[model samples]
Target: MRSLYKIVHTTCQTGWGEQEQRIYNESVWMENKGHQVVIITPMGTPLFTRAKEHGFRVHGVSFKRFSSLKDYGQLKQIFKDEQPHILNTHSKADSNIALPAAKKTGVPCRILSRHISDPVRNTWNNRKIYKQLTHFIFTTSDYTTQHLQQVFKLKDMEIFSMPSGIIPPQDLAPKESARKALARDLCLDATTRFIGFAGTISKDREVDTILKALKLIQSQIPHHIAILGEGTPDCLAELKTLAKDLGIGEKVHFIGAKEDVWPYYRAFDCKVLAPGNKNKIPLEGVPLALLEAMYSSCPVIGSKTCGITDIIVDKKTGLLFDPQKPKNLADMILDTIANEAATLERVHQARELVRKKYTIDAMGRNIIRIYRLHQVKIARQYLV
Candidate 1:
């Protein structure tokens, strides 16, 4: 029999966003594949409940967002109890304590999943800690593995890459109903095309720039933008007010956080993302929102950054625009609207790419392959 216990160390719940989605989907799919999968994380009540809700067992370790060692002891205790053949860690916190403990316990194999492209603020020290891990896993092709190889000074092959594929819902909602609910929220008119964006929309989103471009865009084309997801409310309101100042205030809708974002995608004719790279932390590694939009066959337009190039083939799979040029972004949106057939073709290509390359069944198996390569297989002897 083979079993694996995964410690997702991220201080977040599944279904919320990227990391959560990856953790949840991988664990659930692995369990369905007949592996005894258990997820360890601090947000126990929710993560655990959701895991069981999805038909998998979960182990919770108390964790603090800023401190990786906060759950060190609890994690060690779980390690002893579960006796997982491999200690697979997702969060840096789990790696801080779990990696070394796995070595101490003679767990045989310890692996770390590096889902973030952005450099951690404390990366100087974190790289040193990463050296202890048995293997490193990356979710996208552009993780700067060579840079990490130089910093960690390990073999070039020590770092491995495996990007996250899309995880689609069992059903998609009706198009007209989804559009009605969304259009009503934005008070959008029949003439206005709603360009929707989901996930983290921080100031770094250059949303102000998007708002600025809106003034120019509205002159040529009437459109509404919906920026959804939770964050600093004051900051978000400030962005909305910026829209008002730009005379596109009412046109730019800022809806706060969501538990379920599928309908949001269905409502959108095109999905846009402005996640930015900041402080070495590249806002990347295959965002779930963009993947979901692609599956829905919604046209995707994004800034060319980090792992985005691996997924988006500009003018082929989707359109790419310069992050610094709001005018370019606006023009791309206009072009997409005017060239509906071409934009729709991009959507078709994006969907085919996702169905072929990006999906839980596809990516999970790839990740599982690496985990199994180093996984310990014990033999039992029988005496007659």
Candidate 2:
């Protein structure tokens, strides 16, 4: 077993996405097992500050993506000071900062986890670093690494697939009251069938496609959409206009964002995720939002992108729709509503699948195994 000092670095802690959440959640879990997991993140709010004060260590560093050479060199000083046994960097940009630090400190394990599958940053310089400086390039999917290899020729035994695991959203029967209260606050009819969606509804979401689909189906069914996200003014305005043009503006309510999403999940009869490919850069992988939705006994409809395919089994646990077709989203939504038993049975299976394969505890165990394997390899290398 490795010592109780494994330091990881990322950008910040204000945003509560999978990338930020997992890094801390896994860190805390490892800490519980007597390991110290320090993360190099920017400042957090009072709540996050309190949590850190309790036990977990948070190192503040202003490491921006478009930073100068001095930024990386400054972070390198942290590695030298900490002398961490393992240095795990979350993003590729952050990897750029952590790379030299790991090299200069001679940290045995420097793992870079690729959370997104964007091909834009799969650069020659990064590939060379993966070949030479970095210890391993840990990716979320084999499909992701395959594309990276095809485009940038970053191939190695060191490149491995390691997905972030899903934690079942907290269960709350009393929380049902909170869901009803939110509906009341929104002025939604007590009888309306509410379908919901929650994610980064930016340009990549293509939520207008879902809106068009909702328009197609609204004439036949009495349903409401409860959206949960915030984005730029332009994208948000475009979505509002799309809903207004579809004649369902009043029926669709934008909930923006909430710290606790379980209440929203309980209020939703179904969940929808509509993602568009940003250029050829495929947005693939099992998103935690979909897993949380499924875990909450809600059926789901997702796009056929590689990442989402890992969890969504069409007509089984959830439905897969063509992102380009307006009617496809409508058809799937209607079908999911029509077959409530099958839809719910799929939810049950999805929850079970997550329990077996995608729990945070399972992910922690896998990560520990990977660390041990790498450590053993390191030990044999310098026995002379």
Candidate 3:
């Protein structure tokens, strides 16, 4: 018989980022499967709002810093009262607080979901905290899991790799209707071959590369660039200047973060992900946005990176580009536009790939399996 578990997710994120969506998807699936779930986030934040909108039990606490005593007390008290089977936390601030609180409250499973590949500062305190955690959950496969194990030296700790899952759109509108709606909103012509880049507009995401590539093929293709997601005002301004410098300022449109980016995916001819090398913590996971695009039947041109490699089968499912070489990205864009029939075929195959391997249902089942396996392992250790 399947066991029902009480799962609590804690995060310090204020925005509706990948981590927030990931938890929301998992919680929905687990709840349907008879698991009780609660999400703890700061009040009035986008994540908190979305969790409430989705009917998930939510607790709002300040996530201002790592050492907020008041918030820590509240979190610890909640853990004690709830007595959750699993306390899953995302981000460093939440993880540090939740791990100790879970231990103090005698929570059986304390899993820290590390979403990025950024190296944690190797300090005595951090090492100590890492050693006490019950398990580490990595969103990416081998790259991040192996890197963190080496960094934190968690040879004995249990770890699991679960890629972030996306809920596919239920009613996919036709390409013409989507393009018409986007064009109407953005004031572009219907014939425009819209290229899109979704996710945060930070420097690490390399939105500049998309702008530069658009400039390279501006004369060759009747195209416009639509950048979705939010970023710091300074970073947004910097991208605007880059667009002007590349002489494609008018062709590039920044439609700040949207509650729904599926329509944009529907309108895009090709989706692109270009992460730069300059980031302190480089992009390393299979981006949920990439999976969404693939599921929407939009072909992708992703940088050859860890997570991207796992999904894209180089020219079969989606095209892979070198982030360092802007020209490589430009070439792929032009090729995708030129070979429309072949690109559509690839998009179809990519959709099948996402359906088979990356749906929310699949992710939920895998996570439950992990929980059960961990329980059995602990039971065996106790018997020994």
Candidate 4:
């Protein structure tokens, strides 16, 4: 018989980005598999509201830094009341409060999920939080797991690199149809070819790299790039200015954030992720967008850095280019456009990889296996 576990997930983030979406999707997966799932987030936040609407038991606590005494108290109480078999914290602020509460309340399986590839400083506080407070750590990518191992000198078994998985779409519109629909919405001609980017619009994301690459090939290729996400107003303005200055403003369409991006992925001639590598802390994890794009049978191009490399296998599954060089990206985009047979071959390979490994079912089952292992270990300890 399968043992059903009550799992409590905590995240401090208010935004509905990839991390929050992962938590929600995982919670839904857990629930469907007969587990009782609880969410703890700040009151009135998007996650809190969404979880509540989805009929999960939710507790709202302000996870503010340094003044988290109230948050800690509330979490400790919730831990005692809920007695969850697994307590998973998703962000630093939430982890700081919730892990200790779980520890004091004797939660058997405490986990801290690190979602980004950002570098972790080896501070005493960090050491205690990562190594002492949590029983196991879940990172979104191997790069992050290895980085944590180096910083904390953690054993290999103590950390798991489990990227959030996607549910492969069942009924997607045909590529040409999707393209024509998107073109109509964007007020472009049905024949217009689109290169697409669907992620947060930030400096670290390096959307400008795509713009620069587009500028390089615009005259020759005569294609438009649809950016299907938003950023801070300043960032958006700056990008628009850069596009204008490069004389490709008309070619770049900032579609802002969309409720449904799968259509955009389907509409794309090729999808790109171009996160820069200059930051001290790496920002990209195994990006879910790229996985979705690949599963959509869209050809993908990514900067050869961070977790982007984990999915795009040079020229096999997808193409990669140096983020530092716009020409490299331009050349790769041109290659994807020019080589129809090669690009389609890579797209098929990429889709197969996603179906085999990157589905939500795969991730949920693996995580359940980990939970069961810990449950057995705890039982043995109790018997002893």
Most accurate candidate by lDDT: 4
lDDT of each: 0.70, 0.75, 0.83, 0.91
Which structure is stronger by TM-score: 1 or 4?
4
Model 2 spans > 4 angstroms off: 3-5, 12-16, 42-55, 64-69, 120-123, 151-157, 174-179
lDDT (10s digit) by residue, model 3, range 1-384: 239999999999887767877888788889998999999988998888978998888999887865477777888899888878888888878877777878887888778887887666778777766666656564465567777777777663366667887787789889888988888888777776699999888888888888888888899998889899889999999999989988998888999988788888999989999875434445667788899999999889998776787788888999988887889999999999899888988999999999988889888887887788778877988999
Poorest stretch of ten by lDDT in candidate 1: 375-384
Query: Least lDDT summed over 10 consecutive residues: which range in candidate 2?
Result: 42-51
Models sorted by lDDT, best on top:
4, 3, 2, 1
Residue 66 shift from truth in candidate 2, angstroms? 8.2
Worst 10 residues of 4 by lDDT: 276-285
Model 1 lDDT tens row, 233-272: 7778788778887888778887887777888888777877
For 198-253, candidate 4 gives per-residue lDDT tens digits of 98899988999999999998888978999988799999999999999999999899
Consecutive 10-residue window with the lowest summed lDDT within model 3 = 275-284
Model 2 per-residue lDDT tens digits across residues 1-384: 465556665543356677777776777778887777777766664424644776766666656656637667767777777777888887656676767767877887878787788774656787666666776777776668776667666656667777777766565445356557667878765566688889988878878887888899888888888899878889899899989988989888888978788778777778899887777566855687887787777788998775777788888878998888979889999988898789878888887877876778877887777778787888888784
**lDDT against true structure, model 2:** 0.75
Residue 249 accuracy (lDDT) in model 3:
86
- For every candidate in turn, the CA RMSD to the true structure comes to 4.3, 2.9, 2.6, 1.4
Q: Superpose all Cα atoms of candidate 2 onto the true structure and report the RMSD in Å to 1 decimal.
A: 2.9
- The positional error of residue 369 in candidate 4, measured at the CA in angstroms, is 1.1
